[model samples]
Target chain A: MFQSTGEIIDGVAKITLKGELDAAASGQFKDTIEKMAEQNPKKVVMFMEELDFMASSGLRVLIFAKQKMGAGVDIHLIGCQEPVLNSLEMSGFHHSVYLQETYSEV
Target chain B: MEALQLPATLDALGPIRDYVSEASKKAGLERKAAYNLKLAIDEIATNVILHGYEEAGLSGEIKISFEMNDEKIVLVLEDRGKPYDSRRHEDPSEADLELPLEERAIGGLGIFLALKGVDGFDYQSENGNNRNVFSMNRPN
Candidate 1:
């Protein structure tokens, strides 16, 4: 199961993603992105501490989020597990998104 | 051989990943090796379901089999959708990797990752089915 909760803190749109992020769960992530995009926040930080798995479909949504949020808005991925991070790095997506060890660290 | 058949859909990928993960662990694969096995299979499986079926307006099933040899675990994914050979496809280039986010094309990234994450990747067509065989050797 994938769950996402959104909140605005210090003018940043923060989304906490828990559970696995596979093809079936990407739709919900995209929907949350759309909602956050509507708020037009300057930054969007995804908290992925509990996201244990991520498929290519989930990666595509992150790509989509970058496009939807536009060039001006920054997207940060925090606390992604090694496997999930490997997918990003292998596909050259790690360069596109900001990756931090922790949300507070970024 | 342990075989399982699943409908060719995006939703099937999650369970497929789980199945492969457990099977790899049982086969005595290390944590990273098992993780790579799941990633490689998920990438190929996603392509089989999306491009082979969803984009092509076709429906079929993906049959997966897990077999263990003395040195390696072999995973075979077979699908009846349109033929696509991963061997013939061009992997993402190093120059492409250096390209900025906006300029880089995301196309073929999945296959690139799949091929890189596995020990070996082979593709062949047999009896009107696209067969992708991926293997990972046990970590020494």
Candidate 2:
């Protein structure tokens, strides 16, 4: 399942995703993103500290959000697990988004 | 032409993975490549479990056969429950990843993932059964 929580703080939107990002959990991620987009936040920080696994479907949704939300918004992926990060790199998604090693400084 | 027979069940995922991983390793597949093979097979098994035997209610079995010849690994996954063709792979829009979570479609990613993870993926539906053959060469 996808556990997504979003909040707007200091004009920035922070969305945290945990658990497996599989077919079953993509819907929750999509809904949370739509709600966050409605606020028009300047930047989006996705804290992926607890994310264990991610399928291509989940990654595709991120690509979709980047386009729909426009280029004005920057999405930062922080603390993604190794498997998920490797997947992103293999798919050439690491270039399109910003990845931070740790969320503590974000 | 002895055939390797296995029960078609999610329990088969482990043994199936083990058999593949060992064969790939013996063929000098790199650590990364072996991992990819495992990951790819896991995704296939997951699909079979979720979609193939959805009606089995957690009681279905999947038969997997491993055939290694000439530096290549051919994994034949036979499922009697449903007809799934793995060769009909369509690359989902790379643009969809950016959609807000609720707007994305979940139907195609696993197959894509498995396809990307494996080397040669083929499928044949016959005798009211679905058979998929995933082949990968030994990494140099």
The candidate that achieves the highest TM-score relative to the unseen native structure: 1
Candidate 2 residue-wise lDDT at B20? 67
Clashes of 2: 24
Alpha carbon lDDT of each predicted model: 0.83, 0.72
Query: What is the CAPRI rating of model 1's predicted complex?
Result: medium
Error of 1 at A71 (Å): 1.8
Across A1-106, the per-residue lDDT of candidate 1 in tens digits comes to 8998888777799999998876678789889989988888889899998998777777778777888878778889999998888888877777788899876734
Q: In candidate 1 chain B, what residue range of length 10 has the lowest lDDT sum?
A: B99-108
Provide DockQ values for all models, in the order shown.
0.53, 0.14
Return the clash pairs for model 1, or none.
none
Candidate 2 Cα errors over 4 Å, as ranges:
A104-106, B1-84, B88-112, B119-122, B134-140
What's model 2's overall lDDT?
0.72
In candidate 1, position A87 carries an lDDT of 82
The Cα error of candidate 1 at residue A27, in Å, is: 1.6
